[model samples]
Target: MSSLILGIESSCDETGVALVRLPDGGAVPQLLSHALHSQIDMHRAYGGVVPELASRDHIRRVLPLTEHVLKESGTTLQDVDVVAFTRGPGLAGALLVGAGVACALGAALDRPVLGVHHLEGHLLSPFLSEDPPEFPFIALLVSGGHTQLMRVDGVGDYAILGETIDDAAGEAFDKSAKLMGLPYPGGPELSRLAEGGDPEAFKLPRPLLHSGDLDFSFAGLKTAVLTQAKKLGDDLEARKADLAASTQAAIVDVLVRKTLTALKDTGMRRVVVAGGVGANKLLRAQLNAACAKRQIRVHYPELHLCTDNGAMIAMAAAMRLQAGREQAEKTYAFDVKPRWPLDSLK
Candidate 1:
């Protein structure tokens, strides 16, 4: 029997709702419709997300977004068999908004609800793309505050190959951009500014690039960016673009080199890059070029799905259910895990 899964995501600054059809006989789920409302404009004044404000906005948007998704998908609440929500490693208040709505809806419809790990949603996001990857590939999962490379053998089977010790790559980008006086959501802005600047203009550190292990460290790199910006002093304004370029280059270099190391060690020809940073133009170009020379295959989620979204959450739940890796429960006593680890799923 087929089932319609409704997914909700409010783990941070965005509220997203999506519906997917889980077919019988182990096929990949089909995304029916999805909607996202970003809180960027509302939070720009604060420079970053405010937990209380995010939660309130989610409360105002989730239901309307859900209605919009259902209307677009040509479905109704009665058709939904499972409800899924992002259950963590995010602001506690933001997570609760998603959890509360999902559980309440599940109870109202008398359907089962599934709580999905946020990282797991990102890990499996590529399956929603036109060309989904097979099992046993290397995965570079880079989301907010999290940078990890994992060996994904199958659903629920993951082995962490490496991870950040202090600041993640996303942190490096955002922090460095902030130092340069970029606007909020600095990563993308930094990358945009880098297009016209010379990447070789400034010397930057690639932390742990030669550690003989896959582990990553970007805290030192961030510090280096700050030091360089200060040294520029009055000239910082004129060289901001150059600094952004150099910073982005350093981060991308470390990521590409490390990912290549992982490929060599595992002998896996297939790689999947997911998460917010996966949408980076330079990262995509470099990875594509490198993988092509190696005669290896690379896959990525569609740009829209690269960020935190309800589609990934719903897709993750559907895949888990298909693999018999998890079971949705009728109990609606939903609780959010603000610090859940992806390794815990194993």
Candidate 2:
């Protein structure tokens, strides 16, 4: 029998809700509908997320978004077989909002509740795409402030290969953009400006390019951008685009090379890139070219699903059920983990 899974995501600055149908006989789940509300505009004035504000906003958005998803999917709340939520590695207050709401709904309906690891949601997000990857692929996970490479043998079977020692790729992008006076959500803004500049115009460091291990380091690169920006001083505005391009190039170069190294070491011919940075056009193009040259398949989540969303959470929950890796419990006395580790899921 098929089951309806309702998911809520309030891990950070976005409130997302989605509905997915878990088919019988272990088939891939189908996403019926999803909704997302970004706090970018509200956070823009502060230059970053305010945890308290994020929590309050989730309280206001989660139920509404869930209603919208159910309406769009032509389903009722009573039909939901399970309620899933992001339980952490996020803002403490923000996470509690999601966990509390999910458990409350589950209790009211007497449905089981599942708490999903945030990174696992990202890792499994590619399955929601039209071209889903098979098992035993190299996974490049690049979310906010976290960069990791893992060997995914199957659902719930993951081994970490490498991770960032200091700043992650997203931080390098956003920090560099800030140094160059870019606005809030600097990563995408920097990428857009890069389109008009010469990537080779500014020479930047590619940290740990030949570290002999799959580990990554971007703190040095971020420092280099700051130094270069200061040197440009009066001409910084005029050459900002060049700096943006150079910064993006440095980050992407490191990511692509490291991913390729992971594939070589694991002997995996397929790769799945997930998380927010996976939406980067330059990263996708370069990975595609390099993977195609090696006759390796590269998979990514649909662009719209790249950021934090309910679809990934619901999808993760459904997959775990199908794989028998986890069971949705009836206990609604929930707690949130604000600093959970991905590899610890095993």
Candidate 3:
């Protein structure tokens, strides 16, 4: 009595479609196949996301990608038992594209539809990895617009330990990269440029390094990067790599120290890092070294699954249904939550 679940994710600039098989027995759901299309190239020209363009692109990509996934999986739309989609905390127009498509598909097939929280998809993404984690681990979620530490006991059981007060770690990287005149989607570019530079060449601020709490603040770090760039007016180009490295170092230092603090406070040796920033090589290297020193276990989403993807959405929906935490409804009526809070998913 296995069921095929179709998932769609269009919360932002990426259009992702995936199919997952939910087992009737007590076992993990298996990913059948997935397809993704990133609007990075298009957004690059604009230097950032354009909401209307994003929504339009999502509309064009979702169906084709869904077809691609089904073909790769050797499945048909008629075989799908449920349709799942990202419903909130994203661009309003972009979200509607996914929700509308998912609900319409569900209605046409006379199947149930489930709307998943975007962050929950990220939180549960690592389950798709070869080495999945056990329950009750500390989760460090970092991305372009988010940074938080959470205590995850199980599906739908999450407690926020700390979160960003202003900018997130990803913003620190991207903004700093921009200040250095790097291209759009600056974080990865900055990381690459940093490879040849001395991380200690420039002194950058580690905001809230000792806030006595788990909360984070990276807004000031962005300002510091701007100040440094201006100070190097004539030599900025030659020293850009060093600045990038320094900025990355400062951000990583704060993230690692705060994560360690959270680990110590919770006495949990296992940690899960999710979201786009989880793909950062330096962060992974530093975190690995730090965790190994403490003899702690760290789990991550497969590299391909680190970013926003429909696979995570499908897996999350399947798990939620299996856990009996939520139900797919026949009513296809839907709305998007562009500002939904993760903790509020409580």
Number of clashes in every candidate structure?
0, 0, 0
TM-score of each: 0.99, 0.99, 0.99
Per-residue lDDT over 52-120 for candidate 2, one digit per residue giving the tens place of the 0 to 100 score: 999999999999899999999999999999999999889999999999999999999999999998899
- Report lDDT (Cα) of residue 232, candidate 2: 96
Candidate 2 lDDT for residue 178: 85
Per-residue lDDT tens digits for candidate 1, residues 225-246, read 9999999999999999899999
Please provide, for model 3 over 1-346, each residue's C-alpha lDDT reduced to its tens digit, 9 standing for 90 to 100.
9999999999999999999999998699999999999999999999989999999999999999999999999999999999999998899999999999999999999999999999999999999999999998999999998999999988989999999999988888888888888999999999999999999998888888998999999999999999999999999999988988899999999988999999999999899999999999888999999999999999999999999999999999999999888999998899989998887764
- Model 1 TM-score is 0.99
lDDT of 1 at 55: 96
Compared with the true structure, all predictions reach lDDT values of: 0.93, 0.94, 0.94
Candidate with the larger lDDT of 1 and 2: 2
Deviation in Å, model 2, residue 179 alpha carbon: 0.8
Residue 248 local lDDT, model 1: 93
Candidate 1: regions farther than 4 A off: none
